[model samples]
Each structure stands twice: as C-alpha cells, then as structure tokens.
Target: MKVGLYFGTFNPVHIGHIIIANHLAENSELDQIWMVLTPHNPLKKKAGLLEDYHRLHMVHLATEKFEKIQASDIEFKLPQPNYTINTLVHLEEKFPKHEFSLIMGEDNLKGFHKWKNYEAILAHYHLYVYPRISESTIPEQFKDHPHIHKIEAPVIELSSTFIRNNIKEGKNIEPMLPEKVWEYIDHNLFYRK
Candidate 1:
C-alpha cells in the first residue's frame, strides 16, 4: 500500500486536520493516509500538550469514519523526543512491502533542510506538501526537487491551539471539531484550562 504519514501532536484533533488529510487521500495518488500521533516532538514545547493516549483517542474519534484515513499510535512506541528520520526508518523495516511518503504543510517545507538526515529522507521517500498560510519561502534547493510534490490542496488555517484557547474561554468551538471529537472533548472537559 502507498501510505502518506501525516504526523502531528493532535492535542485535540479538529476539522482542519480532517479536511487536509481527507483532501490528500482523495485528491492524491496515495492509497492511505496515516495520522501518526507523536508522543513528543523535539521542536515543540511540552506545555499544554495532552497525554499521548488522550491525543491518540481524539485522533481516532476524528478519523474513525474515514476509510482512507486512520489514526496511528506508532510514534508512542518509539523512543521519546521522536525524529521523523527514525520513524521513517522503523516504518520501512516494519512494512517492507508498503511505500511510505510524508504529508506536510507548506510552512514545514521552509525548515525541511534542518531536519535530521533530511537529505537521506528526500533520497528515500517522497514528500507531499499541502498549502499553508505562511510567509516563509521554501528553500531554493527544494524548489524543484523530484522527491518533493507540492499538492494543490486547500489551505486550512485553523489550528488546535486556537480551538483550545476558545474552549478555555467558554466559547463554542463545536464547528471547528469533528462531531465525535467535539463530544469527546466536551465530555472529558479537555483543554478547558
């Protein structure tokens, strides 16, 4: 199977994430899109981040109905301070028959060169980038790279932080989240700090 790994902390999975993942799954040649839930991202601060399982459960809630998209807890089993390179290598070994690609936003592309063994990643796997509202330009070297495919997906500006903040302030973020996810958060009182 051709799978695109869409990695995220997914503190609280929302509609924007679902929209982008679904867009790639339906519009691109990818057979499946795995929403890999990361336990901890090296570049991000830990504050306000939900526990791994809570985040994973929300992802499951958000993607349960989508046949082409599924939630993965693959990173949770790996070592902490996870890096994309390590995860990619592990996935390749675990699923030799499957071709794995990356699903990322245009904003991430600007810092792609700084990732661990980024050159190796480019050499081994194709990157499918969706549009994002960002001011940074993609590096010159990656502009026309064969391994990088810029998908003309919709630009979703919504974010988990925005949803969390609104919920904390007693605002209705129901429309910003998937129905099941919204219910899960409402029941558990998540992100209402």
Candidate 2:
C-alpha cells in the first residue's frame, strides 16, 4: 500500500484537514492517507495544546467516515521531539511492504531544508505538497525536484486556532469542524478558555 502521512497536532480536527487529506487520497496515486497525530512537534509551542489522546480522538472523529483516510498515533509511542525522518524510518521498518510518502503544505516546504536529514527523506520518500497562502517561496532545490509533487489542491485558509478562539469567545464554529468532532469538543468543553 502507498500511504501518505499527514502529520498534525489536530488540537481540534477541522474541515480543512479533511479536505486536504481527502483531496490527496482521491486525486493522487496514494492509496491511503494516514493522519499521524504528533504528540509534540519540535517546531511548535506546547502551550494551549490539548492532551495527546484528546487530539488523537478528534482526529479519529474527523477521519472516521473517509474510506481512504485513517488516524494514527504512531508518534505517540515514539520518543519526544521526533523528526519526520525518524518517523519515516520507523514506519519503513515496521511496514516494509507499504511505501510511505509525506503530505505537507506549501508553507512547510519553505523550511524543508532546515529539517533534520531532509536530504535523506527526499531520497527515500516522495513529498505530496498542497497549496497554502504564504509569502515565502519554496526553496530553489525543491521547486523542481522530481520527488516533490505539488498538488493543486484548494487553498484552505482555515485553522484550528481560529476555531478554538471562536469557540472560546462564544462564537459558533460548528460548521468549521466535522459534525462528530464538533460534538466531541462541545461535549467535553475543549478549547474554551
């Protein structure tokens, strides 16, 4: 199986995530899209982040209906501050039959060169990048790289922060989330600071 790893904190899994995952799964050569729930991203601040299982549960809720997309907690079992390269290596060892690729936004591509062992990742796995509204240009080396595939997916400007902030301010963000995810968040009173 060819799988594309869509890594995210998914503080509260929203529709934008589903759209991108679905788009890649249906439009690309990937047979499956794994929504990898990162327990802690080295690049991000941990403040205001939900617990790992809560985030993972929200991801499950968001992706449960999709046939090609599924949620994963593979990183939760790995060491903290894990890099993409390490995860890829572990996945390859465990599931040797499956070819794994990366699913990232164009914004992330801007800093791809800074990642640990990025060259090794490029050599081993294909990167499926989707469009994001960002000012920075992708690195010169990756712009035309054969391994990096630029997908013409929709430009979804929505974010989990926006949803959390709106919910905290007593604004309705139900439409921005999957119906089940919204119910879970509402029932648990998540992100209501």
- Let me know the TM-score candidate 1 reaches against the reference structure: 0.96
lDDT of 2 by residue, 48-76 (tens): 79888899988988888899999999998
Off by over 4 Å in 1: 41-45
On the 0 to 100 scale, the lDDT of residue 144 in model 1 is 98
Best by lDDT: 2
Clashes of 2: 0
Model 2: clashing residue pairs?
none
TM-score of each: 0.96, 0.96
lDDT by residue (tens digit), candidate 1, 1-193? 9999999889888898999999989999899999999786566777789888888998998998999999999888888777899999999999999999999998899888899999999999999998889798999999999999999987888999999999999999899999999998999998888
